[model samples]
Target chain A: MDPSQVDVPPLKDLTIDNITDNVKLINSGCPDPRLKYLLERLVQHMHDFARETRLSHNEWMTAIQFLTSVGQICTDVRQEFILLSDILGLSLLVDSIDHPKPASSTEGTVLGPFHTHDAPPEPNGTQIAHDPAGEPCLVLCTVKDTEGKPIEGVKIDIWETDSSGKYDVQYEGREAPDQRAVMTSDAEGIFWFKAIVPVPYPIPNDGPVGKLLTLLKRHCYRPSHMHFMMEKEGFDHLITALYLRGDPYETSDAVFGVKESLLIDLGKVSAGQAKTYGVKEGGKLMSYDFVLVSEKESRELREKNAMYAMKDLGLRMKLYNGLPIPEVD
Target chain B: MDPSQVDVPPLKDLTIDNITDNVKLINSGCPDPRLKYLLERLVQHMHDFARETRLSHNEWMTAIQFLTSVGQICTDVRQEFILLSDILGLSLLVDSIDHPKPASSTEGTVLGPFHTHDAPPEPNGTQIAHDPAGEPCLVLCTVKDTEGKPIEGVKIDIWETDSSGKYDVQYEGREAPDQRAVMTSDAEGIFWFKAIVPVPYPIPNDGPVGKLLTLLKRHCYRPSHMHFMMEKEGFDHLITALYLRGDPYETSDAVFGVKESLLIDLGKVSAGQAKTYGVKEGGKLMSYDFVLVSEKESRELREKNAMYAMKDLGLRMKLYNGLPIPEVD
Candidate 1:
């Protein structure tokens, strides 16, 4: 063995090249061809971007901390990160890319922060509101086919906030789901739920996401509205929500989930129409209908079960062994 | 407020498209465009990578932990992460892209981990070995123009290990810069350092880098070689090391810092050449002459400092909110 080769010093680490390497590892092997390409290109671009911005470890850790807080704030009723996604226009961008509308049917908007499948179905024109003090209202919805023909017997699942701006899931269980009800349309593809108009309110922020907003100089509130889950034969399942006529976050919902057609006006009805719905004289009420296109699924359909926390645990174990998983549970 | 316009959640503070908006409070800008681009890209990719990989909170924290350990392992004498860079071939890629050499000049290898810029200069044909146990050798060199014509007054700053396989910096200040020395040549650009043949040795592996290597299933040793810094007016500054032929790491040096021209063979020398260098009749040494071309200033010179660490500190601070710093100083 020639003795002269041993004593030289090693070079410096943390060069731009190595940083790029670690990022590539994150893109190891995604199943989705398009997602894989997007992620690979994104990883390359991000590494180049980080190197270009000269982002420091100190700053990166803060971002991690903020994301953690965003996760922490999420619960059965709230998803602040989704709100963040909407406002950033990422969700809208993805949604539009995945589901481009032709502008004829009811515009699809974000499925606002609260939605649950299989809500208890109520009879047509029945009051879904548990709060007697909420503004007396009606939600008349028409489930239409592509040709604008009303599709009778279509199931339109509905959930929303009460007059106090709180969801039923937020309260105790065993009573029926408050502000949450399901309705099936009649022969005209028209379905109406007797209820109260939702109140506008801000999303809960008392976490790192809030801290992030302070750093970015922005606000955190979502306009109030009812959510809709509808399914029809030969059409994709629609998970969407409609917005009220007037609220502050109309243009800048934190989740950027709004679409132009989803906005609807609840016009005042004549006393003659109100009497048919058992409304007292001078009682305030509203009605509107929604149109849903087939909702295409983007990601591989992972079995979504009630044991979400367990699924999250399982996913973590998988990745610890260097396996990859989607961020959702 | 038009309630119809209000279905979206309010925009929040978690995202920003520009780095300057956050860094502006500090009044500093990144100098290198590529570095800037890299840092920005890194941040974007890492976040997306984390999101895509569903990099969990604990996992993200674990990464931060791993990085800190990597940092803690770095010292004045050893840099395992840098060694990692070398082994991964990142350093070579950088060196190759930045320093393209012509076919005529001595090729550049890694500036191994133990370089101290100021070596004492020696006269032409001077003996550089402090121990007589080294191989008795002669390095006859001829410096010339790119066309092979000789040039004068060339200086060759050289340093290398001794027969014991240790560097001056490897051990404490007990030995006076063992087998390494600086030397200048005649008007022709030819000079050599006479040192005992050094043995190959393993780099420091008792730290974080060592731990990482253990995890990565990699070795921590490098081949033996002498460090060389060839600088002249009009020639590109070549900071490189020469690898002795036949060392084990000559093929798999933990740093992968080897080049073809860097490989040199040591043979027995004549009594007449030994007498000229003041070596005894049968001393141990070898001979090597470096041929260099007119060094071109690196093209990156037109660019600013492109290192990501400097470019990204603010982002680090912003993300981590004051990450713990290593007590290296």
Candidate 2:
């Protein structure tokens, strides 16, 4: 034995009881306090989960391979990881935690993989579905503050799948985008648009997320719904969706985006009543009122802005540090 | 109001307390009981971790992007996901749990990312290092069963980094593989090889795992050590390494592959003592004896074999089911 090395300590053997602490120690040097805290908790939970499951080495390797496939399948137009998060109900959980809405305001859901920044703006009552193949539905929506007062000029960005349950992006060789529009509320905070009744649609199922759902023996269909992102200068932005009543998948949306307040009745209207809104006979008229919450205080607004600025700076640093540019929208 | 649709149940709101249950419910349809159990525990821990950290939307997105990058960077030659697991101390934890050694047997560690099937076989006492780069070290190891009797004819596969801490794979244009050899134990269960003193080396640091280590302010160097895989019929395979005592990183291996019993003294030997092993002048010698556990009862072995067969069938089904081929090794 070498005397110089005789003083070396024996390796601290790791066990189920000690593994969490060992991992925590490994992450103790994280420079950012928040990052450190997150990693520590993450390590703890991950180990606990593994132990609780008695995860075999083979199972763990399978998980690693699954996640790798999820990442590799992602493209400029697709985000399989985000889809995994959605189906796992993580997306909604995060959204709910981040944006706790008052009872008077609209409930939020996931910003499912479809939102785009360059939505075409059109006047109120414009027909969003250029060539409708489903029942004509007239959407009459009113935007209001918590006090029930009108909050005019709020931007309401909307998008949905067509009668065939396909987004414009899903179609090949499509000439123009359909089933989407951006419109602003009027002086009365009332907005209306002509669109087909959005049908229940399966999320992109050819990817790893779909395979996971299949393996889990779960359906991949989301309830028929219209996605909406309502925003204004002072109010908090709301990313939510209105699930149509009577949709079979309403009770079990694969992405779990459903909420009581977000469900609406698409009641049938008389031909005369439909004509009043420029809809053809036998059309449906659905009326919804979205309530927004005003900014709480100047200091709170300033803090929020600062947080966003910090996030932007961190993102820039990550980019400058040679991190891969994420293709997320 | 649409009376026909009035019977739908109210959406089950998800709170921090209920998010875990919601995710569990989503996975309730999984046919495999083991998979269902694992996913339930995994979902619970993941949600708890996120909630405990109060992870913000931006931070969550950042994590997703990080994992995506890790998956994207993996290739047949590299496994960024495994590297991530190693740095997080998960790989060792799993290995320790899966392979609990008896008190008399040698402890096991991580296989690491460096093991290859193309290692050249050599005769006993063969010099693995073709040229002089560092101080010569002769490794003499014996294989045995738990009874302490010699177990000959066991394959002993070995590999390590050169004196400069560079593996043969890391070199741009290597003339031949270095610091690696495969040999079998003789009648006395003894095997010997000559090679340069293995030096501590940093893991591949150009990938996302390296970037993560940097972000965590953690070093990426593993302690200087050797790799070994000893296997024979009717006995468990042992994948482990011998850590060099007194190495600076011994106490803080980046991959946490160190164990006290696995640590040994590389004692300096006199020229006279070295001549017996064909070493020139001053040299070092390391003597290690690996004891493997015998296979359990026939019932246990049969059960294990059946479980593995089921896993193989599942994997084949997954492939035939149109899941993307994973690019990870």
Winning candidate number (lDDT): 2
DockQ of candidates 1 onward, in order?
Answer: 0.05, 0.27
lDDT of 1 by residue, A1-329 (tens): 12243332323222345535543342332334333433444446544444444343334434434444454456655565555544344344333333334445454445554666547888887878879878877666678865677777777778877877777755656355777787888888888778887776655556555544433334555666677777777554566677765666665554544444566666775688677766665655555555555433211111121123226545332222222533442
Where's the lowest-lDDT run of ten residues in candidate 2 chain B? B317-326
Off by over 4 Å in 2: A1-12, A118-136, A171-182, A267-281, A284-286, A295-329, B1-12, B117-136, B168-182, B268-281, B297-329
**Predicted candidate 2 versus true structure: per-residue lDDT over A17-91, tens digit per residue:** 676777677666565666776687778877766654445567888988898899898765567888898888788
Best-performing candidate as measured by TM-score: 2
Give candidate 2's error at residue B45 in angstroms. 0.9
Per-candidate TM-score against the hidden true structure? 0.47, 0.80
* Shift of residue A53 alpha carbon in model 1, Å: 2.0
- Candidate 1 Cα errors over 4 Å, as ranges: A1-14, A18-35, A171-176, A257-260, A294-329, B1-329
Instruction: Give candidate 2's error at residue A164 in angstroms.
Output: 3.0
